[model samples]
Structure formats: C-alpha cells, structure tokens
Target: MLVLPALFDEANKLRRLTVEVMQRLDAAGIDSALPDLPGCNESRQPLDAQSLDHWRACAMAAAAHFSATHVLTLRGGVLAAPPEMPGWNYAPVAGRQVLRSMLRARTIAAREAGREETIEALQQLGRREGVELAGWPLGAKLFAQLEDAAPQPDSAQVEIDQGTIGGGGLWLRAEPDEAPEQADTLAAAVAMGISTV
Candidate 1:
C-alpha cells in the first residue's frame, strides 16, 4: 500500500488520520508506505523549486521504490496518483479548489497588511517567482498548473466520503487535533475498499 497525503495545511492537520489508516492497514496484514514528496514532509528541497509534475514523478518513483501494488490517496493527493496503479481515494478534492482557497487567504492577509493584491497579480507573481501563502512557499509553475488541474478519473478504484461522520475540517482548525471517530470510520472504509480491490 502507498498512502498519499493531502497537500499543505490539510496534510499538517490530517497527519494523525493518515497514521490511523496506516495502523489499520498494518493490522489487516497489508504492508503500507507513506513516502514524502520531494518538496514535502521532512525533505530539504524548497517547495518553490518544485512543480506539480515533479511531485507526480516523485510519487511514481516512490511507488516503484516501495513496490506499491495499490495506492491510497487523500484530498489533493488524488492529483498525484500513479497512472498504472489501482487505489482508493478518501475525500478527494481538485487542485484548483485547493489553490483558490490559498489565494483567498493570501488576498485577505494582503489587505490586512495594506498590501494590495489581486488574483491576477498573485498569478503573475507566481509565474515570475514563487508566492508565499500561509507560510508555504509554493512554486509559480506548480501554482499555475494547479489552476487547471482536476482529479484523475481513474486514480482510485474506490472513493470514500466521510463528510456525514464529521466534525469541522481539521485543517481549518487553529490548533490541529485528532478526530478518532472520523479516523475510525475512514479506516473501516479503507479496509473494506482494500479487501474488495
């Protein structure tokens, strides 16, 4: 198993969830790997130096390195799924949506700081030099690519939604915390999905 986590803030907030899922998979006797992308996790690579395609390639390489027969994507990770593998997606979201949300946050901050910034201006800046949003220095090339990215149609063999079992989105919380119920529900769903796959 190869588990792909959500990008940026979502990744930070959902770390526990990923661990829970991994534990469940291990208990079910399915070995799993959560490889860090080049510009992510504990990597030394600068985020501004990486493009979306680079991340995809990194994911493919990790999958190969781990001998992953199937993938497990969460949130924006759906965008990086290896084309040749079958997998499950847990609450997948589009890249563009994620970018737009980040942009909105930047816009608000810019206004508060008395620095005017429009979406077009930010896009232009991203095109020239990487833009920093919510402390993450995202590459201009990657930002541009995200503007038009949609989730891959065949990325996952199973799609699981746990919205109904939810509290608010953990990512949006000021202090990140765990949702055991949500994790439990998601783990059970993933286990079932893997069994069928």
Candidate 2:
C-alpha cells in the first residue's frame, strides 16, 4: 500500500523528520508515496483558487501512478472513495480540529493587520475548510499541540491508528496579514514528512 500524506500540513515545517521517516520506511521495503497536491509545495498554483474537486483530481492522478492500492490522509474532509479504484479506504483524520486552528491563526493575523478584506476572505476559507475558527479555544488548543508535535514518533516508525499517527503540526498558508516566515516554516515541516532525503 502507498502511504499518502495529508495535503497542506504534510510537508509544512517538518521536512527533515519527514524525509527521515520515509527513508526508514523505504529501507524496510514498505511502499509509500507523497503525492503533491495542487497549491502545495512544488505544485505550481496559489491556494486562493484551489477547490475540493481539484484536490480530489490530484489524488486520483497520484493513485494512478501506483498499481497497488493507495491510502490518503486528507484534510478538509475532501477525500472520498473513488469508484474506479479498488482497495481504497477513507481515513478521516482530525480535519475539523486542524481547520479550526487554521482559521484562528488566519483570522487573528488579518485582524492584527487591520485588513477587513483579508479577514472576510479567511472566514470564507474557514467555512470551506469545514471548521469554525471563532472562539473554539479547546479545539484550538488541541490543534496547537501540533506546535510541538513531533514529525516522527518516538519509535521512528509509528503506525497509523484510526486515521492519524504523527500528523498534527500543520502550518497552513498564512493570511496576508501574517508573517511569511511562519508560513515558510510550516511548509518546510510538512515537506520533511514526505522527504526521503
């Protein structure tokens, strides 16, 4: 089976750790591939125009690259079982929690920047992401735990349970009001998860 990663957060800040994990997995002869989605790293596109359907198409293409079955850890609750594909399972990882956190960070950044337009845009983004970022501190806190969430499990090869294993600290594209460094760091972290270098 191919171990696909979560879209946005998969390669965010934890690039090194991600590569290390993949290397170990490959050495053990375990099959896996981190398909690049539209608007993500190395995929030529902007996040502003991406849609759920676009992501599904990218995933389908990735699945086609491999003859065996594919497993995806998708956020935004966007992944659905493909009728044409055999042996596919929908692992609904903690999408709601992640979305909530993303909204919080984005909305806060917009508010700080004094940009009403940006704030509205982020609110819309939050809605599409399927989780409200308004006043969900508890959920936000859980998501914040990703701040220190390790890219690799302590054992270096934790198995996916239920729907998640070591995926939590995702730094989504920040609002225009936010700092680019934060977003860059996040993107790097996610890349580490998919990297074999």
Local distance difference test values of all predictions, in order: 0.81, 0.42
lDDT tens digits by residue: candidate 1, 1-197: 88999888889888988888788788888899998777888989988888888888988899889988889888888877875688877777888788878888899999999998887787788768768877789887888887777777765446776574467766667777888778777777767767777
| Reference-based TM-score of each model | 0.91, 0.50
Model 2, 24-130: lDDT tens per residue?
Answer: 54555546576565655687775545554456566667667775353434332224224344322222334445554556566676668896535446544444442
Which sections of candidate 2 miss by over 4 Å?
72-94, 114-197
Q: Which segments of model 1 are wrong by more than 4 Å?
A: none
Superposed Cα deviation of residue 39, candidate 1 (Å)? 1.0
TM-score of 1: 0.91
Instruction: Give the true-structure RMSD of model 2.
Output: 11.4
Write down the TM-score for model 2. 0.50
**lDDT (C-alpha) at residue 165 in model 1:** 41
Worst window of 10 by summed lDDT in candidate 1? 156-165
Error in Å for residue 141 of model 1? 1.5
